[model samples]
Target: MAADGTFSPVPTGEKSPEGAIGPRSNTGQKGGAGALIDYCTVVLPESSIEDHGVTWLPNLIGQLFGTNGAIVVGSIRNKPWQFYSQSAVLLDREGEMVGRVGLGGNGSTICVSLSGAGCRWVTRWDNVAKAVERWRGKLSRVDVAYDDYDGECLDVHALRERAAQGDFASGGRPPMHRFLSDEGHGTGCTLYVGAKGHKELCVYEKGKQLGLKTSPWVRAEVRMYGKHTALPLDVLTRPLDYLRGAYSVLQEIITGFCTRIRTTRKAVEATGTAMVEWMHRQVGPAINLLREAFGASWADFAEVHIAREGHPGRFRGVAKGDRLAQLMREELCPS
Candidate 1:
């Protein structure tokens, strides 16, 4: 709350679209720089107007952010958020809003959110973290985003394929996912894993998002909710590690592939990520019913029917040899 027994406020950024770890890795090696702390929301520990003054809100921000650039640009008359009801926008050297504060009366919880640019501009995270530590602030949410330039790691298509193959599944089942494309509208594409309020991940074309029609830059982001999990301030210092910990697939950075190993695989039917969906809808039920009715003899009839059929109608024409092998190669894309 403000010193005058009023309130303070945050910037107006879009909240996560409603609808929407594997391990603890200490590998601070290469590529951590690629991850960006695009968004952050922290709730200040219990506070009162008596301890600090009406100006205490800004003063607290100044101490945590190490600057007096907080312009009390908001009040109850112009609340930035619906809950906090009052706010102040924290400006940087460039007068850009690096962060915003949400405050109400004494004992009312205060909230603060830093934007993508704000996260990059804040260089004193470690020092300010100490101040927050003393106050015992709690992180409500944080988004760790990584840009895979030209899909150096993996693109949206790869993510969709992998999810279909259950590569992103940490628990036994893969999370729900949806793919949205501009369909040549020039807006770009996006892949969403899981949903809101749950562990969610969004992988999209960053360059295309910026209007680069042909740019291949893909960005992957993981949003963490501290409502149930304990979020440490170290997430700010090592966002990349946290991101990798979100999905085991993300940790497998594709550096490239060796031609020798690529050509040495055994000759088997070319099945890709789509194989799972097809099997579930087509093969699984039929086999289950056959087994239920015929018992051990189900295989005799089912396998005989499948073998006699030779190949499914869809694969009747994309027969073996180089043409069929090419289909397999495409599915094993390095990207």
Candidate 2:
């Protein structure tokens, strides 16, 4: 209610109450850097405005208003700050007013939050295309924040918590994002969780930047899958009959293999920064299996390659008996 005898009740909803200062409306939206929203407010214990930072506002407003908004400056209770709308002001601790700032549109809508010494505003996008054009290049970085540490180390559970919080970098913050992976010695999905409320499964490869999506059917093989290696025929029986026994065994093995490969690929993509410990724990056995499989597939091709180096004749028959002896003799005899 206002100072006048007007009646006002708070807005209520499942996510947030109306008229209450919750987070931004786009708090969990996702898109490229240009559409990113980067704003932070450090609310003080007191009820008035204090000092604040302007570094994240420009990109933030650019995402919100496009490129037509403008900022106007003025004094508010003798506080120094910038305002996107003339009515909205960002205050400094010294109480000196700056100006109103926006993408410069005549009828742009905006959202604002006022705390002690800090203020944030999300101007509505009037010219989204123009805004994307004007601010896309200017926005650099993808800042990723994670969930609070609950007296636990960074692991899969922590990663799950981060995913629950949507902790991946968004709204053109900065590229320096962070995330946790499953710490348990088991196989699991690779995830990219946003801090401001976003999460996605990703296929990250080593020495890469972006992550890829994994096949929904594949899953990591952990200790729970047990150490008993089954023959190709054993897995084909009963409930394992997914494809009607027509190579169902192959399908399951391939799915399991793909899952492991995708997880490793994701680790490679993020260059292990996001899931290093998890990768280190799983990659060794995965690589060994790959090598063994590759070796078995091309076993006969090995002799053919050696003969192709100019042996001619019945190389296969002649090459078999003295292959090791010939190799050592050639090395010792030089040329």
lDDT string, candidate 1, 49-114, tens digits: 234443456566666654445332333245646376577776555445566777775347777777
State the displacement of the C-alpha of residue 59, model 2, in Å, after optimal TM-score superposition.
15
Query: What local distance difference test score does each model get?
Result: 0.57, 0.27
Clashes of 2: 60
TM-score of each predicted structure versus truth: 0.59, 0.17
Which candidate number has the best lDDT?
A: 1
Clashing pairs in 1: 3-53, 3-54, 4-54, 8-86, 8-87, 9-86, 9-87, 9-88, 20-195, 20-196
Candidate 2 has a TM-score of 0.17
Return the lDDT, model 1, position 108: 71
Best by TM-score: 1
